[model samples]
Target: MSGTLGIDFGTSNSAAGISVDGTPQLIPLEGDELTMPTAVFFDFESKKMRVGAEASEALLRGDEGRYMRGLKSLLGTRLIRESRMLLGERLDFIDIIARFLHEVKTRAETATGETFTKALSGRPVRFHSEDDAKDAQALVDLKECYARAGFDDVAFMNEPEAAALANRDVMQSGDLGLIVDIGGGTSDFTLFRQKGAQDIDILGSYGVRIGGTDFDRRLSITRVMPQLGMGSPIRHAFGNDTHLAPNGIFNDLATWAKIPFLYGPDTIRAAKDLHKFAVHETRLARLVKVLEEELGHDLAFAVEAGKIMANTPDVENPVIRVGMLKRKAVLPLPAEMMTKKLSGLANQIGEAAEATLAEAQIAPDAVTHLIFVGGSSLMQVVENALTSRLPSAQVHRGAALTAIIDGLALGTTQAF
Candidate 1:
């Protein structure tokens, strides 16, 4: 409470903590809960904003409002700075993110009876892995967001490195460990050598712009989008020839960050035009209904839920409950099918981990432990991919949702 506050501002969830007498203690963001969903809702009736679980509740209850998630994925893009009208005010993504962070700061202060003026935040090793300029700008943007959130100064630590710190006890003295921290928008890795009970030597860190949301998007595209006329043929107005529907709308519909933007007038008109074509009118009609009724997020949430259920070992006949889109509409998502759809992405994560070890000039077998963190790390397919690559390493699990914040809270003692 006295020094720096630690914040894990993740794409799917967010948490805050601080060092209390040299021990990391998480602040309860919601009632008796340490972590909160990184979601926001603006109520049209009250003209008030809602954050975290309350926001999700408002969305689920079908309250008339705008709901947004995956805001973290927009940090490096121009859209983050573009203004939109919300609740009678012009606000950009930066302002929206800053407001979420400010809520965190306020809750932490209220919970601990201490104001936090400085912060130590967790960030992916690469916000935009393929674009260096965007990656650099992401950090700058995040810093400004922290400042706007009432933090006078803020420092950042790689998310996987933070997880490594939080799980230092998982490795023996002088043993090498690899931390695989997969979140909603990115997958990060950290290679480190355990030095002592409270010390470690970092070898290297790497990341890729792929994670759980990507899995959801893929599942939606292959399983759900087709039902909404993703690949249906569209007839030309004057000619007998027909072409497959454009992929852009379906792609955006599957993507979490792109859903909110698809509700605009131009996009709806495009969907209607696609619906007007002679090929498979029913499927395209569904697409038009989704746009006009603003049901993209509901579909996205259903897909995400289905993915989680499919990943669970005991669940059978898991299905995406899309009854909101239509009467008793459900998309079957068997575990094997989900695994097959996601195997490529899981392999990509494995490749990134191996690349990290290669960059550090270390052999795969040299790593004695594989510490898995982040919510997405719970997927069996991802674990299988990683374990197959490092067959000799022992696998361990860190606190999936809180490891980064725990480490950031511990790092606060030395951050300043």
Candidate 2:
């Protein structure tokens, strides 16, 4: 059996959706699953590569010298993160990205139990740039990677336009709406003016490189790290590594922003050293994921608690403890800290949405509907900020982080 597929190859998570009876349904990543974390795991010894759900888990335990995740954001680029395993074997960043895509394709095919080919993937209307040139070279790298992964044909469309197509049937005559896709690395907007069921026109598109990952890093560096005073001492001993954003913060990070550190010279430094930072920051994500899912307690929180209380606060061994930052231990940051970070992002999301509207020549009053699309759109901060801007419009369910890809899958099939 042969079926066309639509893909949203996102930075933090990747999703596939299928069209059934003119209705779009998000295809299970490994079957019976709505989405796949766009993570990559590599066994330097076995050279085995894994992606999606299982990969997300294994990669966190990933050896610092090996295993890589979050390459979906690296698509269409030559920039590669280097990871060296215990024995000193190194893996390229682009290779990690290719392997993740391969895993995504393999799992989808395996779940459906079909030999399928040809895909239409969603592309951001605006790509992140190093020096302001449109990232054409990155696109070329991505096409090459997809081809190498065995797809016979690959195509792309504007992410929001594709999302609009997914909800095309919901459009009525004279329907006008806005799309606010707060994705892993960017917050994008599109104005849709529907003339008919199949004749939706993209009135305009605008975007900015801001989203969820920014908040996570905010918590890590500002809230958690400072609480632990994780500097100089840890750097001298542990080699200046040990960076993370929690699963909760990561989900927030998934809301969008190209970089984790949103501002300052430190932010620029992180951008230039993105590869190294990805490794360092992901370790933070790994720590949080492990503490929450594996330990089954807030042991992580205890250390963070001590840091705030007396810098030597103590707790029982079974519970959270302190004095571990020097030894490379975990902590649960203060709630108030995470909240402050969220508020900061909230302000940016609002400003970016307003600025995009001005650029598109559309006023807030002209917006009839404002929809949130992308995995990061699930963030309360993002939703509240975007909604506050469009007081008169409607914001659709963005829970289906996979919807954009699903809609694009349907659109590409129709485009054919």
Candidate 3:
């Protein structure tokens, strides 16, 4: 309890941990739940704000409000500095994220009966893989958020490296390990040499801006967009034949992080124009209905839920309920289709893992253990890709949701 706190401010979910009597334990943040959903809702009628699960519940309960998830994805993007009107006041995104982090700090202090001024926060290896300046800016923004959340000072640890530290005890000295961490916002890989129970040496690390949210978007585009006039036709201005509907709007709708930006007046007017000059006008009408009612997030949630369910072994056909639409409907997602849809993304992650080994000057067969961390690592596609690439190495699974925090907690005890 006297040590620094370890916080994993994740894209899909978040958790905080601390070392208690030499053992790492996750603090209960959401009424006995170890992790809380990263979501927020602003109710206009009540002029109130809700965070985590309560935020999602408020939106699902038919409240008049704006529901936002994937807030972490905004970091390093222009939207992070943008402001929006809420309850007659303009608010910045950074402050909104700080509010969520502050709630985490409050609950952890209450659970441990101790106050924390310093934190060891977990961060991806790269926020923007292709841009160096933006990646560095992401760290600055996160540090500013921690400051606003009432922390005196904070330090960061690479998420995959933290996962490595958490599992170091189980690995023998001289064992080469590979850590594959696929979370909601990014995929990270780390190569390390375990030197003993308490010592480890990192070799190389790589990360890409793709993860569970990206899978949700691809699934939405494959299954949901067709139903909402993606491939449908519109009347041509001069030619006798019709032309396909423009993909710009559908692409935005399929993306979870871009939903809020598509509700402006200009986008609505454009959709209306498409609806007017359309073959199969009903589908475009449904698209218009979604924009008019601000149901993009709702549909995104449904798609994400279905995608997760379909990844399970027992589930054959997962049904995605679209209750927000005028006529309630369900989309049945078959397992094969879901797997096929995500193969491309999974392959990219696999390639990143392979590249990590090469970057460290180690062969694929040299790795003694291939460790899987994070929630999205459980997907069949991801597993298949990893196992296929590292056939000789034994696979290990860390605590899917807590390994990063556990590592951070242990890190706080070290001199570095």
Candidate 4:
């Protein structure tokens, strides 16, 4: 029998591995890197599709292509099934995601010289926290994606639960631990008790549809979008009356998944009309330029970079570089301001963690360890929120990007 592949198909990044001699061995999906960014670029000139860092490089080089990130977030939405033309191919989000996953499988096979027939994939506890139907549909959609990616069969484990499994050794027998897996699009929690050296009993798992992307969106809406006339007024077509610009365009522009869809001709025309009727014509002109030039992804990248800079400690004068929009255009993003903007979301995550404990009938102080995994868990704001709620627990940082894949790989032998 061929081995079972373990895949962590994440909203921002992805990884794959397999169990070797009962130990997890991660594949180098991108030339010695265990994880690859979940991004794709459809090149117009070459009529090709590029995945991972190559795709990002294509976008950074200002190539003529459609660059898409956050493909995982579209799984449960209507947009996932909507077809669009890309590089002479009519494809939907599922097809796009399948291609990316297929590339991962090919790379893994090439690296390890092994055939994988079955898969054990890591997924969030809730893909759409507010909608049960969408959440369930997301699983069905992902299973189909795996099948399309060439896996014969697939099994799923909650992301936080996978992290919990991987970090079980961090706690001694009888110790209670909480796993906080904060990724690009979701924050997940898992409560478990370490029963033995290599085992744990899961108490509960919970997740919320908010993460790094949400932070970037909030920051962009508050700081960057205003420059593009997000809240500026527009004059009536035939009267002196004015109204604030509609938020639809600006909101989509700030969002990672929606940026690619906003490049259509209709949106461009609307932006041009807004520019023409704007009380602040200069600002709306920037908006028109962005839509016409297809710079929404670039703006989003800038916001993401600024978010990282602001999150870093002792960073002097953190600012979002919008020189791409206009020469010398920079937006200041102080750490305090970012915390203020994201505090509410962080609090919600904390409350979710508390709710997980409540569901398990456990007390916050009873958790002896707090294991943090995934990229967004590094944010000081999130740490503050979780620590404030469970101050007695000792915090341990798991492999930020690969913990889920590590656990999945370890579980692959038993998953089948």
Candidate 5:
């Protein structure tokens, strides 16, 4: 059996969808889950690899392995071409990504009881943001990845455009809509004019390489990094305390895409050196511990969970608990605090929204409706920024997680 699949290969999560007798529905990739965490783990002891939630589970189970997440964020960067030693074999980042996608393809086929060859993949409007050459190359790289994943032929669609397609029927006739898609690694905007339930015209699109993971980084740097000697003063051997501990390691630890690559000899040596000169040896010691224990992604996940709980209306554990750090430690990050830390990103998102409107030749007041999509769009900061920028427009919410895939499925019905 042959079928067409629409895949949203997100940085932090992924989902696949297909049209079922004229209705678009998501495929259960992980035990009836519509969305699967975009993660991979290579267990050294078991000599086996896992993908999605199983990968996360294996890593959390204290299994000896190399855990990698934020796979989509590697595209358009130099790391995409990089290689790593896994299970005694050299593997490229692209190879890892392709293997993950291949797993998704296989699971999707099994769930649907059909083989899929033609596909429509969702992508951010700008993979590199403002670098046209890199942005174009990102598409080429992703296409190659898809090919390696076993897709006979694949087409790409801007994520926001796909969301717009999925939600077009919700817009009023002749309404001008704006799609704000704040994803895991990028924020995309699309200004479109919907003529009817089935007719939509895209006026313009813009993207920024900042999203939920960026918010997680900001939170980590502000609330958690200090405890790990991020801003601690480094004492020089000349008896002067003028320098600060190197931030490269801390920064990489805070970033989702860079965490996997942070484990190395040079980094370990630097951490040790920092420990010797750190004004607060305890903090630097914690930093070294994290590095030695390979807890970078665990720290990132803690920050992410904190952000989510802080934004949640009623949550008992609002504090970000960093278990890898000193036991019984916590970082107090309330909703207001997370929002404040995310203000700069909010401004950038607003700018991107304004740029989209300008590029579409539509003034802010001219926008008739605003649609929010993607998991990160659930963040209050994103909502406030877009609402403040487009106050005159009515606000609409799409399926936070499945909108893009649903749209991709709908898009598959139309021309590629």
Candidate 6:
């Protein structure tokens, strides 16, 4: 029998959920995962593209040529076609979208043991669009793509509202709280009052197209590049914004990496590592640009040791790691250094909070507590920022980063 599923189509991470017996249970894929990379891998000659997160941050660091990511940013922007070309030649934007949607759908379908032909997916409240217009057309386009991908009907919900739904149970005091969702590529804020049961009255929501991925990239370019010197072409390899970058380069890179026969004897020996090399530690990318800034000779090829220290649980080692000169040069970013890169996004969160307050006719003190959600919200700096902004209230840390998507799935069977 067909069932309903919830999908969180995050810019960098995605998750799926569903309701069971009036309770929402997050369906795990591959490894009890709630969030997987919005990335795809492909072969120059292949039948279908490989999607879903199959590699780790360390894997991405050693290779970058064929890795595809940040497809969530393709909504209503001028970079639509440029964003989809990563799937292969002559592919439409919906083709790439359908490919990803299909993969996420398939995994959830398998885990739930029921085909999910209908879904409730989360979307940012405002998507940056062409000529200063909202990306309303993107939703229509996505609907068409969803239909083609075998979804009978797909409904949309404001991401924050979905997150608010996930937290409806604990809010017992009739308090108005702020839900801050700091995701991989965007942050969304919503104010809600628990109206008893599953219903939530959303006051006003706020969002910004900036998140953890931005921090990682900023650290890579601003801090990591300075050590390599400015005027490096390697810096040019990454697009200004992950979503705004040219898709041609990304597609071409993906095309080169995926070999037709992955299990064949003639497969690229470094097949898996190829993408990591480019995305995380492109030695050739480094060598190609080193000479421009007079660092070609002085600069040496290095592995991105602790490249993902930001994701690591241990305070002793950064989530991201880089080792240079045969372990002679190891540049590990400290917690403060990483936190500094996240300040701008936190500032944006503050602005969004104030804006929400202004619209709701409420003061800063009126916000009882700030409920922080998403993977990035767990950062100490982000936690402190919320604390400073609503010093009089508590910071609710019980909600998961997967709250929005989980609620979307929960909404599929129950009323939102």
Order candidates by TM-score, high to low: 4, 1, 5, 3, 6, 2
Answer with 3 or 5, whichever has the higher TM-score.
5
Which 10 successive residues of model 3 have the least lDDT summed? 407-416
**TM-score versus the correct structure, for each prediction:** 0.98, 0.70, 0.94, 0.99, 0.96, 0.75
lDDT by residue for model 4 (350-396), tens: 99999999999999999899999999999999999999999999999
How far does residue 400 in candidate 5 sit from its true spot (Å)? 0.3
Q: What is the C-alpha RMSD of each candidate to the true structure, in Å?
A: 0.9, 9.4, 1.9, 0.9, 1.5, 8.7
Which residue pairs in candidate 5 collide?
Answer: none
Residue 17 alpha-carbon offset, candidate 2, angstroms: 3.2
Please write out the lDDT profile of model 6 over residues 79-174, one tens digit for every residue: 454432343466655667777888888988887778887888888776541233546766776677678678888888888888887888666657
Say which prediction, candidate 1 or candidate 3, comes out ahead on TM-score.
1
| Better by lDDT, candidate 6 or 4 | 4
Superior by TM-score: candidate 3 or candidate 6: 3
Put down candidate 1 lDDT per residue, 111-143, tens digits, no spaces. Answer: 888878999999999999999999999999999
Among residues 3 or more apart in sequence or in different chains, the pairs in candidate 4 whose N, CA or C atoms overlap within 3 Å are none
**Which has the higher lDDT value, candidate number 2 or candidate number 6?**
6
Between candidates 3 and 4, name the one with more favorable lDDT: 4
Full ranking by lDDT: 1, 4, 5, 3, 6, 2
Give all candidates' CA lDDT scores. 0.93, 0.58, 0.87, 0.93, 0.88, 0.61
Output the lDDT of residue 263, model 2.
23
Candidate 5 stretches with Cα past 4 Å from truth are 314-317
**lDDT value, residue 267 of candidate 6:** 25
The residue ranges of model 6 lying beyond 4 angstroms of the native Cα positions read 44-48, 55-65, 83-89, 129-134, 197-199, 228-320, 324-328, 414-416
